[model samples]
Target: MTYIRTVLGDIEPADLGPTYAHEHLVIDGGRPVELYPDFDLSDVDRAVAELAPARDLGLACVVDAMPCSAGRNVRKLVEISRRSGVHVIAPSGLHLAKYYAADLWSERGSVDELAERFRADIEDGIDEHDYLGPVVERTEYLAGVMKIAGSEPSLTPRERRVYEAAASAHRTTGSPILTHCSEGLGALEQVRLLADHGVDPRHVTLSHTDKVIDRGYHREILATGAFVEYDQGFRWKAGVDNGTLTLLAWLFEDGYGDQLMLGMDAARQGYWTTYGGEPGMTFLLGEFAAAMRERGIGDDAQAALFVRNPARAYAFAPVAVTAG
Candidate 1:
C-alpha cells in the first residue's frame, strides 16, 4: 500500500506498470565548470524525448537513478513523464564522492541531519510552499532509494562519510539503496556496511554491473538477494561480442532470472545515432527479444526476463497477457 506523489498526482505503487528499474533521465560527469560553457545540458525536453522509443516498445516506467549533483533534474522529469505516459521515478539522494563539491559537504550539517532531510522529502515534500520554506522543505519529500559510490575497492574517508549519510537516510526514511560502483571493488563492501547499519539487503540494487567480476562474484551478490542490473542497451558492436547475452544465459541457467534486469545506460548525446540504437527504452527490449529468438530461446524464458522479472522486482503491475 505504498503511495508515490508525482507531478501528475499521487498514485499507488501498483499503478507503476512494467518498469525499467534502472535508467537515467539526465547525466553529467561532473566535469569542470568550463566543460559546458552554455550549461544547457540540463534540458528536460531532450531527456524526455529519449524515452519515446521505450513507450513504443511496451515500456511503462523508468526509474531515473541520476542523483542530485550528477545531472538529476526532478522538475523536468515530471514534465517528461507527463509527455511520455511512462512513469519516471526520480532520485533525491547524494552522488559519488568526487562530485560532492566542498559547499555541499560543508552544508550537509551531519549524517543525522542529512537523514532527517531525506525523510522529510519522502514523508513531507521538497517544495517550500508545500512544507513552509527551505528548512522544512529540505527535510520533506523523501527519496525512494539512497545512492552512493566509490571509485576504488575500499571506501575513502570522504566516500565513507557519504555512505554513512546514505545509511542514515535509509535508516530514517526506510528508503532502499542503489549504488554506482566503479571497478566493482567497494560495492560489496558498501553493501556490507549498509547491512551493518541495519539497511535491508533485499532493498538494495547494485547497478552498472557490466564490469562486475565474472561468474563467481556475480552469483555471490545474487545470493545476498540484491537486484543485479545489466545495463548494456547502448552497446551494439555485435550480437556475439556483447556480454549481456552471455550473462543472461548464465543467470537463466542458474535459476537467477528473477533477480536480473536490463537497461541501456545510454549517456552520450549522439550514441543513439550510432550503434543502430535509438534514444528510447524500446530499443533494448526489442533487441533482447530479437537476440533471444535468434539464439533459439523461447518466449516463456524471454518473458520472464523482459516483462515478468522487472514488474515483480519493481513492484509494478503484472504485465498484461497478450497473444504471441
Candidate 2:
C-alpha cells in the first residue's frame, strides 16, 4: 500500500486526512530567530495549544516547513504531535542559505554527502541536534518530505547544489519535494531544474506562490503538473480585494482544484491566536471554508484542495531508488 512518512512513523495515505501542505510548527533557535525573534516557536506547550482548534476542525496533518539545521527539532515535533494528535510530516531537506552559516554542510558538502545525509534522515532518523554538533544522535522519528529553496529572481550556484541534493534524496527515497518559491517567483525555473534532475513534476509543490495573485502566472506554474501551494490566505490586506480568495475562485473556475494545496505558513508566533495572533491556526477550515462555499466552491472542491490533492502530491513515488 502507498504510505506517507511522518515524524511519528510511516502511515497509510488514507490516514492523511485534511492535510496542510506547508507550515512551520517548530523553530526553537536558528538564523530565523536571530533575524526575527518572533520565529521562535520553542515552546511545545504553546504550539500544542495553538493547534488545538485546528485539530478540532479536522486538521489531521501538517507538513512542517522547518527542515534539518534550520530550527527543526524532531523531539519537539514528536511531542507536539503526541500532545495535539496532529500527524506531523517533518522535512529532511535544506532551507534557504541565509538560515545557515557560509561554512555549513549545505554550503560546503558535496552533492553525494548532502544526499546521503538526507537519505539517512528519511530511511534512518533525523539528527536530534539537527546536525549542528559533531556527534549526531538520531531519534526514531523519520522525515516525510524533502524541502529546497530558490532565491528571488534567480537560483545561485550554491542553491543549485542544494537543489541537486534534494532531488537526489527524493530520487532515492520517493519523498515528495516541497519548495520555497521566493516571493512566489522562480517557480517555473525551480520546476524546470527539478525536471532536469529527473524528479517528477508531480512529486513537487512550489510554496508561497499565493503571494503572486496573478491567475495567469498560477496557470503557468500549475500547467507544469507541479502542485502550487497557497498559504497567504490570511496575509492579504483589507480594502483591496482578497487576492487569495480571488485566485481560489479563478482556480475553481478553471478546473485546477486537483493541482492546488493549502496551508498557513505561519512561521512566526504572531500568526497564532494562542500567541495573541488574530486568525490563528483555524483560519483555513474555519474562515476560508465559509468564504469558499459562498463563492461556489462546494464541499467537493474543498476536499480536493485540502485532502485529495495533498494525498496525491505528498504521497511517495511509484518506486524508491535503492541508493542515494
Candidate 3:
C-alpha cells in the first residue's frame, strides 16, 4: 500500500492533512549550531509548545527538512510528534556542504556506500547517534523523505555525488525526494540532474523557489512535473510587494495550482513564538492563509496547496519490478 512515512510510523496519504512541506523542528548541536547559534532547537518542550497552537489551528503534519548527520534528531522528532499530536516526517539524506565538517563521510564515501547509509535509515531505522559515531544504533523511527541539496550557480562535485546517491536510494526504496535550491538558483539544473539520475519528476519537490520571483522560471520548473514549495511568505518586509504571494497569484491564475505546495522553512529559533520570536508557526495557517484568500486564492486552490499537493508529493512512489 502507498503510504507517507513519519517518524512514528507510516500513515495513509489521506491521514497527512495540512502539511508543511519544509521545516526544521530539530537542529540539535551540530556544525550548523557552531556557525549560527540560532539553529539549535533541541529542546523538545519548546518545539512541542511551538507546534501546539498550529496543531490546534489544523496543522496535521510537517516534513522536517534537516537531514542526517546535520543536526537531525529522530528521537526528538518522534517525541515532538507524540507530544504535539502532529505527525513529523523526518529526513534521511544530506544537507549543504557548509553544514557538515570538512572530513564528513559524505565527502569521501562512494555513491553506493552513501546510498546504503540512506537506505538503512529508511528500511532499518535512523541511527541513534545520528551517524556521528562508528557505532550505529537505529531507533524505531524510519526516515520518510530523502533530501538532497544543490549550491547556487550550480551543483558542486560533492553535491552531485550526494544527488546521485539520493537517486539510487529513491529508486530502491521508492521514497520521495526533496531538494534545497540554494537562493532559488539552479532549480532547472537540479531538476534535469535528478531526471538524468532516474528520479521521477512527480516524486520530487524543489524547496525555496519562492525566493526567486520570476514567473518564467517557475513555469519551466512546473512544466517538468516536479512540485515547487514556497516558504518565504512571512519573510517579505511590510510596505513591499510580497513576491511569494505574487507568485502564488500568478501561478494559480495560470492554472498550475496542483503542482504547488507551501511551507514555513522556519529553521531559526527566532521564527518560533515559544522561542520568543515573531510570526510563529501559526503564521502560515493563520495570517498567510488569510492573505492567500484576500489575494483571490480561493478555497479550492488553498485546499490543493495545503492538503492534496503535500499528500501526493511526500508519499512514497511505487517501485517497479521486472521478471527475469
Candidate 4:
C-alpha cells in the first residue's frame, strides 16, 4: 500500500492533514549557513517552539526541503517532529549549485552514483554525517521526498545530472519528486525534463512557481499534470497588487485546483516568530486561509490546496517490478 513517509515513520495519506508542501525546518552548518548566516536553524528548541503555534492551528505536516550536504540534519528533524507533534518529511537529493562548495562530491559523482546515494537515503536511511564525511553512518530516519533544482534561463549541465539521478531514484523507490524552480522560472522546463526522464507527472511538484504571475505560463505548467507549489503567500508587499493571490484566483477559476499546493518556504530564521520574525509559520493556515476565502477561493479549494493535493502529490508512487 502507498504511504506518506515522515521523519518519524510512514503514515496513511489521510493522516497527513494540512501540510505545507515546501519548508526549511533545519539548516545546521552547511554552505547555506556560510553564505547566509540567517539560514542557521540548528536550534532544536527554537524549531519546536516555532512550529508549536502552527501545530496548534492544525498544521499536521511539513516537507523539509533541505537535501544532502546542504545542512540536512535528519536527527534534529526527528527531534523537532517528536517535540512539536508535527509530521516532517525530509528530502534526499541536491539543491542549487551555489549552496555547495567548489569541490563537493555531488559535483563529481556520476548520475548512477548520485542515484545510489539518494536511493540509500530512501530505502536504507539518511547518513548521520549528512554525506560529508568519509564514513556514512545512516540513521533510522529515511527521506520521504526527492528534491531537484534547476537554474534560470535553462538547466545547467550539473543541474541536469542531478535531475537525472533524482528521476532514477524516484523510479526505483517510488518516492515523490519535489523541485526548486529558481525565481519561479524553468518550471515548465523542469517538468518536461523530468517527464523525459520517466518521472510520473502526478508524483512531481514544482516549487516557488508563484514568483511568476502570468496566467498563461501557469496554465502551460498545469497542462502537463504536475503539481505547482506556491510559497509566497506572505511575501507580497502591503498595498501593492498581490500577484500570488491573483494567480491563485486565476488558476482556481480555471479549474486547476487539484494541481495546486501551498507552503511557507520559510528558509531563514528571520521568517519565524520564535526567532523574532513577523507573520510566523501560522500565516498560511490562519491569515492566508482568510485571504483565500476573501478572494472567493472557498473551503473546497482551500482543502485541495492544503490537504488533498498534498496528500496525493507527496505520497510515494507505486514502483513497478518485472518478473525475472
Report lDDT (CA) for all predictions.
0.61, 0.90, 0.93, 0.93
Q: Give a tens-digit lDDT track for model 1, residues 1-324.
A: 434444355466556555676776655335322354322235566656666766777777776676655555455666788787887665656656555556663134576766665555555654433222244334223345555666676777666766777777666555566777776555678778778877666667777776653777778788877777777645636544667677777777788877777666555554443233354456666766687667655677766665665554443112234677
For residues 265-287, write the lDDT of model 3, one tens digit per residue. Answer: 99999999988997899998999
| Least well predicted 10-residue stretch by lDDT in candidate 1 | 128-137
Residue 152 CA error for candidate 3 (Å)?
A: 0.7
Q: Rate residue 68 of model 2 by lDDT.
A: 76
Question: Mind giving the per-residue lDDT tens digits that candidate 2 earns over 1-324?
Answer: 668998888888877899989988999898889988999989999899989999999999999998879899999999999999999999988888999998988889998999999999998999988999998988988998998889999999888988898888888888899999999899999999999998999999999998998989999898899998999888877778777888889987887889999999999889988789878999999999998898888899999999999989888986653685
lDDT of 1: 0.61
Ranking of all predicted structures according to TM-score, beginning with the best and ending with the worst: 4, 3, 2, 1
TM-scores vs. true structure, each candidate: 0.80, 0.97, 0.98, 0.99
After superposition, the stretches of candidate 1 with alpha carbons farther than 4 Å from their true spots are: 2-14, 27-41, 106-108, 127-142, 273-280, 296-298, 306-324
What is the Cα-based lDDT of residue 207 in candidate 4? 93
3-36 in candidate 4: lDDT tens per residue? 9999899999998999999999999998999999
lDDT of 2 at 254: 88
Q: Report how far residue 239 has shifted in candidate 4, in Å.
A: 0.9
